[model samples]
Target: MNIKKTSVLLTIILISINAFCQQEVSLSSKLKSDKIKAVNRSISLFGDKEDAVEMNAEDESGIGIIEDVEFEKGLIEIELLGENNPGKSFIGIAFNIQNDETYEAIYFRPFNFVAKEQIRKEHMVQYIYHPEFTWRKLRKEKTGEFENEIKMPPNPDDWFKAIIHVEETTVKVFVNDLSEPVLIVDRLTKPLSKKIGIWTGFGSSGRFRNLILKE
Candidate 1:
């Protein structure tokens, strides 16, 4: 082949490879402004794209649901970073989300993981059914059923991976470690398949990237 022809072929191949690697949906494009307060910012996790959805909510109820995606039974893997501070920072995913007001969520209170008090550690991971079954209600009614402490905790300030597996009535959450789930809920509040979203609690700011939904 001629030198020019060879160079052209190489460029084409590189472009194709780059396009394939960046095919994963970006969070910024999936979420709407009214659903959750967010802004586009550069994320190191996604090499092909420079923008990731940064959830900036003054209230804990802010949620960014992915548009046009129906999540029934599958796995959701994403990278999340909670605000690093002494106060509680709720950062996680909500699946089976019917709307902003309704969904089941698995969130992490990073500050609690390394708290001086043992009670705080117990509330490290939480599973809540919005508008009905909250962490407080569940803890009071069903102890040790909805929330639990992480066996292996990650840094609050650093980015960590959260893997969520949902099938019918069962939902399991794995943080950092894929082998064992940190928290499991056998009886899901909303059993049917619904939209998925990235959630942030009141007074919380989070960064999300590489949102992949597999069914």
Candidate 2:
């Protein structure tokens, strides 16, 4: 091929590669008020392993939605710390959030992380689609399908990593550096919105850091 044609071909190849490769987006940069939309939660920015955000709520659920992120199918990973407050510590990531009332989430029950009872152990991690399928509903009807027992649970009082891989039809959650996913479930709701968030359950306070999205 001629030099001009070869140059154009090379440029096209580069653009195609960039489009399909994973692009890491740092969510810590959107700490400003104009960028985050909080629902029934109070958020504060601080420094830990890196720049982090802490969320607290006394009643109802709390979620701090990153306003500009429009994630459909991608990977969301973050370091989260929750106390062993038995039934109070629900810390995890929320995505495809249409609003405060509706969304899909995969949260951890840190209180159940190292439970002695078999039932509690099974409830360590959960996936829920609000306004329809909640933890209570899924547990009652579907039984042990939506939630899973973490074979290697993390410490409740310390920082642990939660990596969630969201896909068109399914979601997989890996705790810490585990090669195998602790929880895997089919996607319940369709693509509602592009919003993604950090969530904490009632009476729970969570510290989050190293929030990243690969798309």
Candidate 3:
């Protein structure tokens, strides 16, 4: 074989090796105080369920950062449940956390999953980078670029699966078993931190389970 062809074969082998070596960690094994760090929120193992944690925000938004885990990329799959509380009910995953105030988050407005109005339906899922590039700012500036409607949305008042694929510059979110992502947006920040978390928005409460992080 020529030198160029040999180099291409070596590159493919290395890529496959790296992908196989990535670890899959289950973060929902326990919801004890030593396992999770709640930021501006309160969390406890859901009384009615096993292997799940419920989160309630104290102010605007709250995060439950998984202790000792640092995830930068790959795939994240979790089950989230929120209510159909109209203006409330924002729940999803957060990663690349720089601090309590600065981080990247992708959350859902469960109430808007099946809204009667077309505009409300379009606002079902959102992507935002905090301290700047907020939902309000993105909506006003980038318009439909950062958020989109979910096709075949799950029940707003019950448990639904979220699969998030994160790359260096892009993020894709899939709801339930959808073949295509419901929301895909170019990442707004250069991911520098390794923090991964579960998030809830203003006056919101959320339940999360089966948290799996593959990296």
Two-way lDDT contest, 1 vs 3, winner: 3
* TM-score for candidate 3, residues paired by index: 0.87
Flag the better candidate by TM-score, 1 or 3: 3
In model 2, state the lDDT of residue 72: 83
The residue-by-residue lDDT of candidate 3 on 1-215, one tens digit each, is: 99999999999999998777565444455465467788989888785546788898565899988878779998888899999889879999999999998999999999998799989999999999997988999999999999999878888998999999999999999999899999999999897999999999988989888877777
- Per-prediction tally of clashes: 3, 0, 0
* lDDT agreement with native, every candidate: 0.73, 0.86, 0.88
Show the colliding residue pairs in model 3: none
TM-score of each: 0.77, 0.87, 0.87
> What's every prediction's RMSD, in angstroms?
8.4, 4.0, 3.8
What does the lDDT come to for candidate 2?
0.86
What is candidate 2's lDDT per residue for 74-149, written digit by digit as tens? 7888899998989789998889998888999999999998799998999999999986998999999999999999
Candidate 1 lDDT, 1-215, residue by residue in tens = 99999999999998887565432656665543333323221112232464466766574467766666667777888888885575548888887776567788888888876776777778888888987888779989998888888877888888888888887888888987759998888855646656777787877767788877766
Query: Which model, 1 or 2, shows the larger lDDT?
Result: 2
- Give the distance in Å from residue 26's predicted Cα in candidate 2 to where it truly belongs: 4.7
